[model samples]
Target chain A: MKIAVLIAPAVHPVSGRPCAGEADLAALALAQRLSSQVDVWYAGAADDAALADYLARGATHIHTLALAAGREVLSPLAEALQDYALVLCGARAGGGDGSGLLPYQLAEQLGRALLPDVLDLSKSDQQWQALQALPKGVRRTLAAKLPLVASVHARAASAVGWSYARLQQGKIQRKAATGAALPQVVLEPARRARALVAASKVSGHARMQGAIAGGEGKSAGIVVKQGDSVEKAQVVLDYLRQHQLVDF
Target chain B: MDFSTQAIPRIDPRRPWVLGPSGLKRIVLGDDSGSRDAALLAHGPAHKPLRSSGPFSQRLLVVAHAERGQLDDAAREAIAAAAILAGKDGEVLALLYGMQDAAPEALAELAVDRALTVADPGYAPEQKLALLQQLLQQESPHTVLFADRSEDADLGRRLACRARLSVVTDVVEIAADGVRRRQPGAGFSLRERAQVLLLARGVAEAKLPFVGKGERLQTAALPAISEQVQDLGSAASPASQLALEEADLIVSAGNGVSNVPGFLALAEALGAAVGASRVAVDDGRFSRDKQVGATGKTVQASAYIALGISGAVQHLQGIKSCRHVIAVNLDAAAPMIKRADLSIIDDCQSFISAFEALVRRERNLV
Candidate 1:
């Protein structure tokens, strides 16, 4: 019954503090609830200051899979995580070329079953039951065997909030990458991306309303008509002193 | 960006893979477009992996195929976007996975020059990934587009990792040199010259232009791979009683909704279908089928009454086709307020009660 949590870092916009990512922290909380054999692991290099946040949250050991320079991350990280029985990751990351695909790719590489958007995790015997989150408030219970990867959602569990005392107690162990380099790998240039919306005055106008000459206008297309009858004729049901007659 | 109806691109084998005269550089590759012409029909060998012949030019490939046969909405958008980007110089190609028989001829409706249908019926995720890897090795496309799905992202990321290609997921806007996406609250990041771009879950699919060439081809089976996982049937129940996609009137709930019974009652009173926001769905208060958002089903309802929804961008994308919207919630600042024609700021449960009482009184008066 070993559980391992994957860690990614998030930089809060307002505070500029590097915190354990929201989704990852939720996953960590679930891992902590699962067993005492829980370890926090990061795939790439991170500032030690940020890694400290996980130690306080309940992770006893932190393993950093230091990707070799010029090596792709998938092979290296996948190879290193082969031994863990249950691996949990956040649904996505907030910063850096974060595509929210690492967890899925890792599962594919590890040849394990992936249960994504997991809101809760419980085990009985050798089987694991996952309360998975889909769109809306609907939840699905998925059962998978060990050597499984699940992506934890925000609603997974109560996260262990940050504490300075635990941060002082956590220790990090670094592991080197083991992937072999490929021949003739083309180097991709730095991606150039800009905000689609320009800086403008904060106005009361709505985005859907402004685009409305002929296209679907938020206000133009709807008719709110429907089944409209009530059984209020049952005056004896309430038996209340009628405010209109009795008060006088 | 005016394209001339008379401008027909000529293929120059000498100029790499660029389409001449149209000057649009990207080449879209599909599994097989029913192209009988020997040149367009013959792309490369069937079983052998391809090593690209030249430097990269603009090209877009749509990897379309889920467990089922029918193409998904995001896949359609990927094709639509590729068509718009193809213009005259670039080309649109579709890559279909599954067994040889799984590739259908219906792709003629799409605005693509050619499409490649690979024989891969089992619909294994890893097998599809391997086939794509082989095709990519031969073409070296400028940008690879995928329908934003959990598995699609996984496959795309695996390709990116193995190929060392720059990648961006959850993209919305398509630019000349690249694509851009807005980070919530934070401004936006643009990815230029990236090798791969994946559309966010809810990019509005574009309408097709007038005609298509209808060329197609079927390829060999994907490489063998061990399958380890089995998909369990959906969790909880199947979904809501009403199909939100077909419903004309939708009474949607959101996070602010407190009285679940009252909310359902409102929908029943109005004779509208029930819908919920992403958060409401995650709260286990509603069925996944009732969700209306980027990850959920889109509806083109005549009127939508939103209760307690905070109008995240993903949710807004789902309601784009909605005709008239009326929102009720306590916070006037929620994004849904701006999208609604009439917004009432109040507690939603109380509002429903008041409406119920008024409706009964109005019926009596009549």
Candidate 2:
């Protein structure tokens, strides 16, 4: 089976230095585990120093579709990734637009099944199965036939460390590609976001009560230092019941 | 003493006089601060007057799924943003992906003029996307809003990409001219509002000065498509197997907990993820990934139960976002006791067994 891992240029959040995103590196690591016939593909400017990090993580060859400024990557990526049986990418980008739409777009354009936020992958009975992560520590398994795309969750695997030896052994092949012009975007310093609050429609007394009682009209916390184990447990249960965290 | 002699009146005319129910009490009458309360008492809780009566000129769309019979927080924010943007001349339309179980008054309170619901079971992204595209083509709304959540995010990106339309996602602020979002590396990005927008949480106030029409619209059935994907049902990972950062409820241990198995069993009974303080991790009783502190994984669980854990500053910092903290310790003067909403001074082992027994009894598992 052939596997392709998609990577993009990432910079450190604080220092603005080149570094591989944790998510993308996990994708590479997962791809390497699936099959040894794995290749790393990048669709951006070829000047990124972070490309070497991918090599150290175990990709022997890096294929770059060198896109100059003002070209969208969807079309070029969709075209270049058509033949591969399995394609892997990060659930979301660590930097840049970070919309995490490339994998979905490519899957849609190539007419392939897309499984996102995949934490583990394995092949059996000529089909690929994945363990997908959900919110609140829940997980769901999904299965689909060959020729699919998956976005790797950050927790999928621990990223491989940087090695100078592997960097020397890897190869980079760059090919200039062109597509649509970039959309107009302007970057600026961030401002505070406005929170959406439902307008209060209570009496002044009710409002005061809410304020004094710490909202939701619940009583303040209580300390139970003088209770036995059963009584203490009962108090805890009552608190949980009041908060609606547990129901019986 | 000249008691019979008439004395001059000692009343001062400049003094402020307050009239009470009776002359004996000093209570003041007609207080302006309580006027609102009085009015509410007379008329009950009145809804805000409608922004517009009818005959809307334009329309904005909000797409989301009803979670547990109501729109979740992120979706409500998006709806509110759309409502604000619609103004008096425009109308806000909500497109829901699940059953129309949200209360009508709640929808009206958010200024949702129209609601269209499509009820389909399971994971059907393709059909949902197609329905959305069809609606977009038909309505031609001024702007479509979506919450940047798990399902909506996927649907929004798919729709935008399929149509090749420029989209703005994770919008933190919205103005008449453009939207703003925190950029990838640092700073923020401001871009002209696109036809489709994915709003970040807490961007708009869902409360409005007026109620919406809150009328329901009928939805067309989705066309059947061939199924190539198989969903293999969801499962809850064991508490010990789950990562601390993603756990909603966590049971953590510290230096005070000696019975690790008892702690684990209690966590399992509560169906909570397990975590450990740095000291416990260093002691090799728990692995490094289960550690919760500044050097460890900072958690944002809804409820954190600390067993025999003295709250260190770093540990407190890690649990700053937790809504509820319950501590079981031997010392009432411990820092953990001070930070916890509920504190119990007891032996960790005894408390663990007692809590577990209560949980099992309450759940009727015994």
Docking class of 2: medium
lDDT of 2 by residue, A149-201 (tens): 99999889976778899889999899989988987678787667655454544
Give, for candidate 1 chain B, the lowest lDDT window spanning 10 residues.
B45-54
Span of ten consecutive residues with least summed lDDT in model 2 chain A = A210-219
lDDT of 1 by residue, A122-228 (tens): 87677777876654234666677888998898666778776777778788888776555523322233344322221222222222223333233323522222222
- The C-alpha local distance difference test score for the whole of candidate 2 amounts to 0.80
Runs with alpha carbons beyond 4 Å of true place in candidate 2: A194-248, B1-53, B109-111, B118-120, B205-213, B218-223, B252-263, B275-351, B361-366
Number of the predicted model whose TM-score against the real structure is largest = 2
Top candidate (lDDT): 2
- What DockQ values do the models have? 0.10, 0.49
Error of 1 at A239 (Å): 39
